[model samples]
Target: MSRPERWIRLRGKPRGPRAFRRDLAETAPGLGAGDLTALLAADGDEILGWGLYHPSSQVAWRELRRGPEPPDEEWVRAAARAAAERRRRSPEIDERLCRVVHAEGDDLPALVVDRYGDLLAVELFSTAALPLARLALPELHEALGTRHHRLALDAAAARAEGEAAWVETSPGCPELVQVEEDGIRFEIDLRRGHKTGFFLDQRENRARLRRQVAAVEEAEVLDVCCYSGGFALAAAAAGAAAVTAVDLDEEALAMARRNANLNRSRSIRFVQADAFGYLRTLAANGRSFDFVVLDPPKFVPSRRERERGLARYHDLNKLALPLVRPGGLLLTCSCSGLLSALEFQERVRQAARRAGRTARLERLTGAGPDHPVRLDFPEGAYLKALWLRIT
Candidate 1:
């Protein structure tokens, strides 16, 4: 089949880097365009760079490789080599927890790469980056000189980008590796674990937990819904006498146990139970903690799920408030973009009231600096961290 074509025009703005768009004219042969609500480069064209276009997504296009000419096989090979070389240079991106390709950051639009020990995970969002990944990943393997690679797809980005359904995970490679976060070390298992094998985004939050725990001598700590034992590890490091982490996922609890061992400490306890169930149990047992960290996964996935998610959040906190000692701390976090900061705050307030407790806001925060939000895209501001003092 003959491919349709379109010229990509570059639009430069004063505030930031320029954007690439479809010009519709100066067409090229054997290049299919337009039928795709989004456009992904299929053939060669004498353009400024190798572009991957997605008209359907919030981000229309991303220029992967920059040049005044079309990207050839040699260009793809060199890109593969350079990406591997860049990954090799970073002490963080070794056989442990590290992000390899971060979409626009790595010059691959809508693509994410994670390194899990000897395993490599790749997530493709754009159609152009998808097929291109299928082609270039082999080259990436050759460049890395490794036979084992695990390509995991993040379907969330694909759905948001308006692409067709894609498979999720592939074969596994390794079991465990030592990972460091904010000077704290953790043991992570890539084969059966969470995103890229660990939640690296919570690095800053863990540091905050450590700081808070250190302020209270031998404070009893509760790390609720603690995935991989991040906050618990931080609390233990901060000199907390006893730290209890609760999560339903057995795999996560296993890794958390390993992470605790890596810290050369066994002062923390792990419980594989539902978050809300454990919270209610603690309340029933008349147990109170000096610090509680409520870091749950995305409860609100879409607009329709917002109301129910908010109710759930409130209910969870309502049960948790009584478990917090008076004048103690409660660190609550919501990564759901659908749950705005104001909405989350209101829910927490309602929870405190229901528990017959008075709470004061101590701090408010968001994701780390690496996950930058665009000026216009407020929805990009997903993670909301709230520190509260219950009295």
Candidate 2:
């Protein structure tokens, strides 16, 4: 059945591709809940795009498609197919585990799809994309060659849309699935894991760390906030003399230990403690590492949290800097979308000054190639990692 369309007129000059939230002058009269509205120009009836109207959300309308034509299941399927094809063509992407659809990167706003071996994990960032995601799933399965799937709603989207946050689409799917990346093995818990079972975006970064450490024998390593020990395992596999992985989550520590055992990486010591306090203890103990990785969770979730987030980043780096031996490598990362790469680098500079050390930036990078960014939307490039060498 064809979907019904409602019309809404914009108030001012047309904004380029954007997420609309109460910026419009007027909405269609008598537009009820669940109406999929087409945005029109203020002066004429020329259609701009299609979006779903939610009266309760600050985002009054969440755009789904851009152009004059109305949106349908076929359009959704085409987007899924295109996203899959792009990933297939990327040499850096491992077909067994990688991102297939990266929300706005694929021009399919608010929907992300990742492949974990035979299992597919889907995430909806907004309620507006829920119906479209459901329509696109069959095509996604065909393109990615997977029938096992899981759907998860962004926590904020769940509250805004008033719907369940998670659902398992395929029965008989295993709770834990093992995936291999760059000759390293990991067991991901699809039902209860961070961001689509694993942090596949850092796949390349971990490999880079391994390659760098492989050249140095008996290198001491530290992985702060290392959920499931991705970097810890990589460093250990590269023949690090000793590796310490720290996180507050006991469940994650347990999994990290299990992963180390799985890979026969006995050098890693899993520690359950707050990262900040642990870093302080390491400094007070006069312990230093040849290499350190700081991959903390998102501190600045929204624009309002920017100031406090920068302070936290500054303090973390200040404590982390003294622990890096002279000429050692420090891989610091920030996943906060509100924090730009320039701002992050500035904060690190401030930390180095406070630590009375000079540092040179070796490399600056973001997520793996699978997580492509749109030219118009720089916010899509959220993950920032700086490889710094202390002097």
Candidate 3:
């Protein structure tokens, strides 16, 4: 489809590099979200960059380029190659399972590619990104040697970009496939599960949790919102004294149970309940753990839901802090890209104050090395984690 030429004018100074509708001085009358065009100044003298006009989104359009280096077909191909080459060069990341393309992190905004064993799960988050990503499937297969591809979109992203969320796989690729991460096996439900059926971004965090649990003698662990039991299983394998995994999704819990058995573990107590309520119950019952993981799903996917999401984070930490025995560690995480690491840390601190617990920050981390973030696109630096020591 031929893209229409529109005066993509900038109006206000955006806080970050991203441009929202409020920042836009003008938009094309009939431009599609994925349609590429040059950005302009209000006076129309400067061509700021290129963008994918996303009218349905809060972000009118994310910057595709800061210069006139067109994101043409060749640019897309090079991006695909560069993204793949970076992952292949990362000796620290397991090739068996890792993120190959991290949207804006790879300079290809709104498109993510995750490799699970033989399957490549491609998630397109914007109309602008969707076409470019689709056009590069052949290149991805050639570079990665993976013919099995599953392309999909989450509901929120789909709605924001005015695109239909779908699940389509290459011929002969099963909807459910088994993949290994750091020697632990997991079953990925690409068609039904959330965000490509696994949280690959938390790979390093899980490893760190395992190390923490194994460091202590007879360490008791609590994993809140333990979807598919990644942290719980890791802790169990580390020989924790006891591990309690809690989540609201029955299906995810069932999978977690199966994973535990696969790892020859009968010790993990898998509880199906709301994490918030469960944490409150555990605290009221005077239950405590030597280590705890609060890996909740994204409480806020967009800026509009930021208030409620921050509240949940604050309250969750408040309840969870009491469960950590003195000198124990609490690894709390937020996947909401909208929440800055500083803001998230403040939330935890506020929660600690409310709970009357002394919490000191020990380490601050984010997604594994596989999920690299671009320097310009700080938005790619979502997934903030705070490792705190409770006294």
- Residue 383 miss distance in model 3 (angstroms): 0.6
Q: Against the hidden reference, what TM-scores do the models get?
A: 0.71, 0.94, 0.95
Per-model C-alpha lDDT, please? 0.69, 0.84, 0.83
Better of 2 and 3 by lDDT: 2
Residue lDDT tens for model 1, 1-391: 2222544433332112223333332233333322121122334333444465555554444555554455555665566566667766755434244555555554545556665545566766555566556656777667665555655555666677565544444454555666577667877665577666777567678888898889998899999888888899889988999999999988888888877887886889899899888888888888999999999989897776888998889998898889889899999989896678999999999999989999999899876543445553345567898899999
Instruction: Pick the winner on lDDT between candidates 1 and 2.
Output: 2
- The per-candidate count of clashes, in order, stands at 3, 0, 1
Error of 2 at 135 (Å): 1.6
Q: For residues 1-391, could you state the per-residue lDDT of candidate 2 as single tens digits?
A: 2323577766775554553555677776777544678877777777878877766555566566787777777877888888888888887678779998898788777788889988888888776677767877888788878878888887777786676676657787777889887777899887668778789889889999999899888899999999988999999989999999999998888888878888999899989999899999999999999999999999887777888999999999999999999989999999997788999999999999999988899999999888988776777889999999997
TM-score computed on alpha carbons, candidate 2: 0.94
Which lDDT value does model 2 have at 77?
82
Backbone clashes in model 2, listed as residue pairs: none
Q: Candidate 1 — which pairs collide?
A: 38-55, 48-67, 95-117
Off by over 4 Å in 1: 1-109, 114-121, 125-128, 131-149, 155-175
Query: Clashing residue pairs, candidate 3?
Result: 34-128
